[model samples]
Target: MSARTTLRARWQRLAEPTLVRRSVVSVLLAFVLVWGVLLCYIFMTYKHTITNDPGLQKYGDALLVSLQDVTNPAHAAAAIDSTETWTYIRRRQIGIFPGKTLHALSDADGNPVFASHELKTLNLPPRHPEAVGVITEAIAEGTVYRIYTGHNARWALQVFEPKRTDAAFLAYNGRFILPYLLLAMPFVLVPVWLSVRNGLKPLQQLASRIARRNNDDLQPVGFDAQHRELKPLEQSLDTLLARMRQKVERERAFVQDAAHEIRTPLAVITAQAHVMARSQSEAERTQAQAHLEQAIARTSHLAQQLLDLAALDEAQRPTPRDLDVAQWLRAALAQAAPRAMARQIELSLDAPDSLTTRLDLPALESVVHNLLDNAVRYSLAGGTVAVGLRVDDGGTTLQLAVQDDGPGIPAAEQGKVFERFYRGPGHAASSGSHNDAGHATNGSGLGLAIVRQAALRMGGQVRLGQGLGGRGVGFFVEIPLAARRG
Candidate 1:
């Protein structure tokens, strides 16, 4: 690129405007421009008033009187220095510096008669009608002269500043003014820049605080700012941080509980495997291998329940749809048939297939499956697990109940059972399986918790009560009818 283009690009880069630069530059540029205009206005406003000055007027009047005696403008010029008319002016103590003053006379017809010695040397122009003073304008460049005219239309008397002295006078004044204008720039801009920077200091401090935080530090922001705007920002950030902290705590607690629950089964599995590996007799080895298989089955069951609970916590709720509760209960109970048979617990459903409402399919299915599993896991051999669906409250509400002949949750301990990883006093099992191959089962304590979560996700509530004939525990779920139409 050419030098001009290169310089232009560099200047453009430097001038790419930011908030601070625009604010400072706009303020300073406006101040300088306004001050410059003000100075120019005051300098020009009544400047011609200087021509009405008594000291300079006296010179023109005296010179005019001296020229009247000589009618021709040329005799007037010769008489000033060549004749005694010059001596008359010395007697009145009138001072005239020839280098600094000019004299000229012209007839009423506009013909020049006489002029001073320097009049021809000075090329001063005449004043136009719009010019503001008795003197022609003071020149700004080259050689400047103030041309003064005294005229009555019949005769004219003109005096000009002799050696462009106006240039020297203006130059002297400019030297005094220019430096001050240059100095004003920094004074105007520095304060503006500083004020803008200071105004954004709180935001800068907020950014620094955020940047310095540890990755796991989800605690609320703690900076106290003087600015009210930052208060809202701080509050919003703190709210999000508080939520994040809670989520992290929940995750930590969940991991601890899962590890504790899974540890027992894994230990049993490892011990049985070791026994099988070390056994000398064939029958002993076979028994140990059977125990290992049972441990493996229990471990798989525990892991599946853990995953189910985790998924419920993380799953986005599916859109609810109008669904037949009796139909869903039948389907869920059918899925639990194998486990129910393995435990020797009979599963049955009571209600017409027409009993229906709106709820999410997976969530409702999860709730029913957990309830059925709990019933089967805790019930006696050949015990009946009855699932029922009905319409309540003038048919505007749906009611679902799962009751069994299993050992029921006592009334006092019922509320606590829904808590995650909660194992009530009488809730222990002999072994850990729903299959016939394993003797007994100890639940992971997440079944009812999952049921409760699923119920809430479907916008319903669950109640704990006695089973048929008050023989065992029952979980009754109630749902709104409006949710279906909505």
Candidate 2:
């Protein structure tokens, strides 16, 4: 293959949907979504917990105690400035400390005594001291702060840090969280991939078993599926195999029967040819020629019947078209008129002036021709052969019946008449006899089989019954009108 073709094939394979790919993708998406939700939950919880840091209150209390011991205003200011400088230096040196803190000292009258550099420009208000340190939120110049207040008898001290924004927190902490999440993914995905592969192992094995089977091995698969999901697949495969086996058996039987039926005519033709070649007089040659012709005719008829049966078996459902069935029946009778006349059999049709319906024309033609041929072949000379077509079952079904005044099949043999190449007990002797027209009355024993199969193909059925005057045989074919009507 060309490079482009190979690439295209690969792309198509990837594009095709597969169960394993779908399952793995679904699991991966769920994993990512769950991880995202967990991250959000952790961020919210940590934000709430850090807002009331206990260590901030302790720092505030210590600052207040230092301020109480300094009575001089300059010394008090110096003490506050010293504390702020120390906090700044420690924050810069230690990674664990807050990134920024602002401090302010106030007297008992709530006047600001001193303020750190960052807080100096802003107006600072003192909070009322509580017995226990209290943490609260305050907003100054559009910046939110988490504030802790502490007080002694003389001085109240305030220390606060700017509350971290969501974006700031993410930037600061994402590096640590993201690496760990990345590290954990392979651990999770490896197990998931293994589980999915193992889960589908049974399906793969089933496919391998099917692939290993030979074409002639139409037996049901023997694999004992352990999974609930695999049972339906196994059953369906077995059912298909069973059907195939039946079809193979039927084909084998048909071939055997066809060979057996053709052999007799072939042998007769061979013998007659030998006789003609060896004949010394014109009469002997003529007799041999006649016999040869008869064998050829029988062989041709049998071949045609075989072809008709095979067509019925192999052809797909035919498309239906509007057909005047009554008119069609008359035409069929006209075509069969020569054979009927030669046998001195009177052919009659009983149908409406105009009966139109949708039908599969070829199937209908096969049915009518086979029935007429069978009737004419079996009916005695001077016998009446009748053809009938009518809409019955309140116009829902079309009934076609052909009857002949000849020897009818016995009740015991009637059921077997439709079998392929099956002739009655005395049919062989009768088949060799000639009619008044010097034409052999041989029957291929396939006419009724063809009729039955053709009727079935048209969604109809054929049944044998009493003929005209109740003395001979009749074939009644009933087809559903509703099924084929346009």
Which digits, one per residue and each the tens of the lDDT, describe model 2 over residues 141-176? 777787887777887678877666777666556554
Error of 2 at 251 (Å): 1.5
- TM-score for candidate 2, please give it: 0.64
Model 2 residue 288 CA deviation in Å: 1.1
lDDT of 1 by residue, 251-274 (tens): 898789889867877887889888
| lDDT score for candidate 2 against the true structure | 0.78
Instruction: For residue 113, give model 2's deviation from the true position in Å.
Output: 16
Clashing pairs in 1: 73-113, 73-114, 74-113, 431-440, 431-441, 432-440, 432-441
